[model samples]
Target: MTTHPAPTVHDVRHEETGEGQPTTGLDAFAVCALSGAYSAVAEARRFTAAILEGWGVCAPVVSDAVLVVSELTGNALRHAAPRGPDAAESRPDLVCAAWLALAHQEAGVLCAVSDSSRAVPALAAPDLMAEEGRGLWIIDRLSESWGWTRPDHTGKTVWAQLPVPRPTR
Candidate 1:
């Protein structure tokens, strides 16, 4: 008997936002695979850098945005694993299908991470000495406002808006 290797996710795509769309001023969008141990964080950095560069956002803000994406994507991978190994292999497909939207809101640049999982992220208290459980906490502190939205509950999108820095005099 032969066992087939599970499928992996790849080939991310990007699209520009349309005028008057529900998500306005969306400069760039991307979707990447969430498979393997580090795919999410890698993709988050890649997408964040691309979007930030395209928008001409400065280095510091871009760095912070990438960090936020890393945390959010990491949480998704850690918590939303598939049932079996084969199932896990197929998870990359789901992750690749996950969407990211970068929009300009009154508050600042909005980074939205959307996934097929309906699970909502919670901010849990972590031991000060602990090495984990601070992803959302960091996000909360850095973002002006962060929250999740589920239009029909089939999936949810978590978002954070970072204020645009003022030009240095």
Candidate 2:
């Protein structure tokens, strides 16, 4: 008997966010496969910060990108997993290895994370007492626009667009 390998997640700019909008395109300047662990979120943030800085992005926007990436990656670490039972199944399909990407556009910077799961992250009312479930909420609050896309026959990519503040004349 043969078993197919679980779907993999790699955000290597399969699409492009033309006109400086990263809502529907990959067009990433940098992309990497991250281990499906919480520690990787910090590395993701650092990677984004470095890439944005190299692109001469404004500090404020870069900061937002770091935070946004953190939240997205953190959510992936906790929720995304390979297909399996919630308890005992090792879910390589859910999030064995997540992909992180950064893109520079006319607007600002786009931070994206792709996981093996096709289920998109949903926003819900925050439970003040709960310790979790606020990742997307924070992303929405900080980002100009955020959404997810399921591409081809693979997984979905969650992305956030942060618009830089224009300088006054």
Clashing pairs counted in every model: 0, 8
- lDDT against the true structure, per candidate, is 0.67, 0.73
* lDDT for model 1: 0.67
Q: In model 1, which regions exceed 4 Å deviation?
A: 1-37, 88-97, 151-153
TM-score to native of every candidate shown? 0.71, 0.73
Native-structure RMSD, model 2? 8.8
In the range 9-73, model 2's lDDT, one tens digit per residue, is 45334454567654643334788778865678888888888888887788988888899999988
lDDT string, candidate 1, 40-118, tens digits:
5797789788878787887888888888888877776666545455864665446354556677544477777666676
Give the TM-score (vs. native) of candidate 2. 0.73
lDDT of 1 at 90: 61
